[model samples]
Target: MQEERRVVFIGKIPSRMTRSELRHRFSVFGDIEECTLHFRSEGDNYGFVTYRYAEEAFAAIESGHKLRRPDEQPFDLCFGGRRQFCRRNYADLDSNREDFDPAPVKSKFDSLDFDTLLRQAQRSLRR
Candidate 1:
């Protein structure tokens, strides 16, 4: 079987969370080749994150947290593909970053019930 390419989606990170900061946070799980932190306006503060591998991506997704904003709404999580990797574009490393929106945060997700997700991932991984 092929090694699954993991693509995790971390949305609604505090607008204050910088790309560097996000990289640091996620890096705790595993190696993160690249990370982009999206921003809304100057300080509206909402965006998404993506990781390179599946295990690291999954670990990040499992660690749930409420948005740092006043409303403190919970956001969704998942993974996606790196555009450059698909195109085999070795020349334009920055192209992928350009396509990534660091603001508004991805809206769609597997509900906000993190407990359910944790149980599911834990159960599935054990098998």
Candidate 2:
């Protein structure tokens, strides 16, 4: 059976760091498919990174991922899994209570009678 992979969430990556550098550091643990550096239209930076496999992704999480120069102090790092990937952490499971069910979704189809719609349309045209 194919191994289930986890999607790791990484934050606090350095703003000035290049993609190549990010790949090199992360590749030491596993294959990295992509690395994106988010930036606001106003030019402020937000740190984010995604990994190809769960094992390497976990290593990165344990490495105390931070937004800093190699010799600098480490910043806060947050690593979590994606729901689609079937990855769940302790915190994720704990937050949801069994007694609290979400509201039933509304149907997508229009339930109003056609005659009512036609009358509304006619009234708008007359106005």
Task: Please provide, for model 1 over 1-127, each residue's C-alpha lDDT reduced to its tens digit, 9 standing for 90 to 100.
Answer: 2234565566666655677876776677777766666665544443344555677767777763532346645656665444535545434444436665544556545465888778988999999
Deviation from native of the Cα of residue 27 in model 2, angstroms: 1.4
Cα error of candidate 1 at position 2, Å: 12
Residue pairs clashing in model 1 are 6-54, 7-79, 7-80, 8-79, 9-78, 15-45, 38-102, 39-102
Question: What TM-score do all the candidates reach, one by one?
Answer: 0.47, 0.46
**Residue by residue across 9-72, what tens digits does model 2's lDDT show?**
5454456666677667667767776666554445444444566676776777777454346764
Instruction: Assess the local accuracy of residue 29 in candidate 1 as a C-alpha lDDT between 0 and 100.
Output: 70
